[model samples]
Target: MITLATSVFGIVLCKGEIIKTSVHGPTGKISYKDEGFGGMPVVFVHSFGGNVSHWDGIKDSLVQNRRVVRIELRGHGDSEFPKDGDYRISSMAKDLATVVNLLGLQRFVLVGHSMGGSVALQYAGENPSRVAGLVLVDSNGDPKKNPEEIRTQIKNVLFSDAYVETTETYWKQLLERSKPEVQERLFEELVRAPKDMVIKITSELLDYDPTLSLKRYVGPKLAIVTPENDDKFSLHRLQLGFPHKVIQNAGHWLQLDQPEAFREILETFLQRY
Candidate 1:
C-alpha cells in the first residue's frame, strides 16, 4: 500500500499534493487532507468506512476556483478511533464543525457520501448559517432502510474473514464498474482503514435517522440519488423532505463512476448558490 505524505506546505498546496494534517476534535485528533486554501473552502466527508482519497478525482476540478478539504471523521481513515462512546451522528457533526473552526473556514460547501452524507446533513442541521451549500451523494439518512436482518448480515460480512480475503472487491463496490482508473489509490486507502471503525460505523448507520436534520436545513442542499434502485425507494426518499436529483446507472459511488456528471452537478449547484 502507498503511504501519502506531504511537505511543510500542508494538503492545500499550490502543487497537487495531500498533506497529512491533524485537527483536534472534542474526543481526539482527526486526520484529513486540505487542498487550495484561501478561496471558499469545500469540505469533503467520506462514507461509513472511507478514507480521504475518495474525493481525489473531483478534488482538482473543485480546487481550481475553491479550497477543497477532505476529512477523515473520527473512527474512520487515519483518525483516532476510541474504544467507546455513542459515536452518534450529532457528535460527528460537532467534529466537522471543529475542523471548520481549526481551518478558519467561515463559509464552505459540505459534500459527503454514504455515512458521510448523513454526517453532513447533521452538521447542516446544527449550523445552518455556516454552510454555504450542501451535497449528499448516495447518502443514507434513515434507520428504516436496513432491517435487523440486513444490518446483522452486513455486520457479519464486514467483520468476517471472507471480507478480509475479498477486501479488494468490497472496496471496489463503491467504485464505478465502468471506469477502472482508480485501482492503485483505492487499493491503498481501502486497507488503511481500521476494521473496528468499520463495524462501529455500521452499527451507528443502522441506527441513524436524518429526516429531521434534512427538514431543518433551508439552504442549498442536493441529494444525488442513484437510479439503480427501484422507483419506489427513490420516490419515497425524494418526497421524504429534501430535494434531490438522480445520477442514472451509477451505484452508491457516483463520484467515482460518473466524475463528469458529478462534477457538473456540483458546479451547477455552487454556481447557482
Candidate 2:
C-alpha cells in the first residue's frame, strides 16, 4: 500500500528513506528507497518530472536477486526543492555521488531513464571507478537533436501562465500504454514537480552535450530505446558506438508500456557482468 506525507509545499510519499544531504554547497534532501539485498547494487534513476515510482513495474523483479536503489531527485518527488535553484544535470549527478558515498557503494550498475540517463552518464563520467556498467533507457543523450529549438519550444510551454492544459495533453500522449493507476499517479507527480526547477534543468539540459560523458565511460554500456522514440534519438546511431537495443512496439515510457520485455532486456544485460 502507498503511504503519503503531505506538507504545505506539496505531497511526498513515505515509501523510502528521506536522505538529508547537500550538493554543490546547496543543502537539501532526497527521498531514496534502498532495497538492501546483497550482491551488486543497481541504481535506477527516473526521467524528467518522474520520481522513484516510475520504476515500480520492474522494481520487484530487479530486487529479487540483487540490491536495487531508486532515488527521487530534488524537486521531483518527496525530495526537497533546492533553495539555490540549481537543478543542473551536473547537480543531480553530484547528488547521486553523495548517495553513493553515503551508502558506501563501491562498484555497481547505473540505470537511468530519459533525463535520468543523462544524469547517470554524467555521474559515470565524473566518477568512473564507482560505476561497473551503464544502462541508458530512452535517454536524452543523442547529440543530433537541436537543443536551441527544443529549448525554445519547452520554454514557451513551461514558462507560460497556463501550462497545465498543455501538460495534460502531453501526458495523455506520453502515458499511452500505462495502466490507469500508473497513469494517474505519474501524471500527478509530473504536474506536481516545481515548474521553475523543471524549466531550468531542462533548458540547461538542451545546451548540455552528453557525448563527452558517454565517451568517458569505458565500462560496459547498453542503450535501450523504443520504436516510437527512434525518431527523436536514433537507435542505429547509438548502436554504431555502443550496444543498443530496441523494445519492439513500445513507446518512450517502455518500462511502463512493456515491463516484461524491459525486464528481459535488463536480465540479458545484467548477465554480462
Q: Model 2 — which ten-residue stretch has the worst lDDT?
A: 17-26
Which residues of candidate 2, in runs, are more than 4 Å off? 1-26, 147-150, 177-181, 231-240
Cand. 2 TM to true fold: 0.82
RMSD (Å) per prediction: 4.9, 5.2
Q: Which segments of model 1 are wrong by more than 4 Å?
A: 1-20, 37-39, 83-86, 145-192, 229-240
Quote each prediction's TM-score. 0.77, 0.82
lDDT of 1 at 270: 80
Q: What is the lDDT of residue 211 in candidate 2?
A: 71
lDDT of each: 0.73, 0.75
